[model samples]
Target: MNVRARPFIPAALAVLIGCTAFTSVQADEVQVAVAANFTAPIQAIASDFEKDTGHKLIAAYGATGQFYTQIKNGAPFEVFLAADDTTPERLEKEGDTVPGSRFTYAIGTLALWSAKEGYIDGTDKALLANQYTHLSIANPKAAPYGLAATQVLAKLDLTDKVKNKIVEGQNITQAYQFVSTGNAELGFVALSQIYKNGKVSDGSAWIVPEAMHDPIRQDAVILKKGENNPAAKALADYLKGPKATAIIKSYGYHL
Candidate 1:
């Protein structure tokens, strides 16, 4: 998650950028498979990248697990922006991606959020007493964020106590919806979904401590389909630039 001047210009494109005057890359679209947790910031970054490089991006956002299945079965995505590094690394090992194209783009943060203000009292300590009617979380088996949420509960010794109160979502986006819509009083969700402009937008939340779970090392990789596609490589490169890093940080992610 280091922010550096990485603009994934193809060797041919590099000369074009170095010139004082240059045309952008061809108007080709990159098909990206993105994790649900990154939905907001990636869209913003994609827009900026399109303007700068003239390469459009079409994104499919969902659980990383589902994307893995689709990719293994020949989903035509040129890039995979996973919520965890594990998936991209696996893709590389399985020959689904361009070699040496994988790198962590962002480190994600978790949050315990509620729809109403003043509802969540503190750092999930109140949950030990079973105070809430229902608790929501992404399906741990499918979503890395959900797995991280389970890890936090385990660290706090609340897993067994709240087993029955749990409501699961197919992905992090849906899990956030459960809390945002009052379907569940509270839920564990990616901070990016609830944070903007240096604050939580509409809910009470506790930024889950990093020690509770392993780092959510989100990585991006160019898939085999994009091995020769300049647009796909360029998008992957744009993800490491200052503009993309700034947008990601604004959403409460770290680089």
Candidate 2:
């Protein structure tokens, strides 16, 4: 009897098919609303997270307050990285987040930064001197960093002295932009915006004292939308991992 020859599957093609199947079943994507101050660190951490966990993170960076409003309005965010603890706490109370999912991810450090090298003397004295024509700050109503900046100014008793010279950005990224673009001579920004590897990446900066304002206890939480999303919980856990912690610290944020 004549036997028909069977078609053979190539090893490489078989392996490729297996990987595609595994990825389709095991990999997932999460939608994250990240605080503007956390943009850099999150971007860095996301790369490693994706590589290690086979999950993808899609992040939108903006003011924490603005994000809160968006979330309340039914934004499809699976995770929230707020610049302050209160917003997440409020969301939890309002039943918008997964219960017991809130935790502090990083303690932010505020900084007075100027794109021009040596423009700031790294002290409150530079602020008290009132030498700059324009000073940029994020809108305190929307950004926790802005609120911290205002508190620092109030503690220094320079709020009135600098009122006329103040320029507002909608978020911390824009606040930094105001100074980086030379539109403002200096600005109050997140240290992570200008810091790298334990030093300011460019320009001059004075890291604000923790005593100057309430601690910026940045919190992360899984929103109700993410209650059943495995990728969302994976990312939340990844943020607490050593790799992400190192990236956060390298950006000048306190863990």
Candidate 3:
């Protein structure tokens, strides 16, 4: 006599399995707000973080100051990666971030980049010469990279000469885009924006030395909303780890 085996899964058990899978997928996602200057490295690191930890990162990139305002207004971000230490420190002091979880993740480098090969002529003094009709930089009030650009100009004694020629972008990403699109002859941006895979891009660039300005110490912190989130804490710690540091360094950022 031939016999057939009974179906193993009950209808109720199948529904329970589906619900469990959905909850696991939801739990693995972590929301993050990252400063614009760090966009490249963070995108690279996020992929590695997910591969190694099985946690997904949903990152939003913008000016550090703007993100600070949004977080203050109750944006639901579990982690905040800022372009400078000031904003993260302020958040912690205000109790908006998890106290004691703040740390520097990278040291940012500023660069004056021109999409054309020789537009900047390899020196910043050209700004004083007024050889370029328009220069782009992030808004000093909103972006840390913009603050560094302003310092570079002041140090070169060209602030007066270039002040009126400046065209401001809301964030470093836009500043870079302005130059890339030829809307601005040149622009100040984060080195990471043009540096990748252990080399700088084809654009003309003058890397601003660290001594000329206040250090751009990129800091990362867990928000109060993430105080109890294990995945956010894991990512914050992983960013400080060797693997992540290597990826950051490849993009010309110091850790």
Which candidate comes out best when scored by TM-score? 2
Candidate with the greatest lDDT versus the true structure: 2
Total clashing pairs for each candidate: 0, 0, 0
Ranking by lDDT: 2, 1, 3
* Candidate 1 collision pairs: none
Per-model TM-score on C-alpha atoms: 0.89, 0.92, 0.89
lDDT of 3 by residue, 1-255 (tens): 999998889999999999999768655778999999888888889889988887899999999999999999999999999999999999999989888899999999998888988766666655656788889999899899999999988998889888888999999999998889999988899999998776667778888889989999999999999888778988998998999999889989987
| Window of ten residues with lowest summed lDDT in model 1 | 17-26
Give the per-residue Cα lDDT of candidate 2 at 10: 100
Ranking, TM-score, top scorer first: 2, 1, 3
Model 2: lDDT of residue 181:
99
The per-residue C-alpha lDDT of model 2 at residue 133 equals 95
Q: Candidate 1: where is the Cα deviation over 4 Å? A: 1-25
CA lDDT of every candidate: 0.90, 0.94, 0.89
RMSD of each: 10.1, 3.8, 5.4
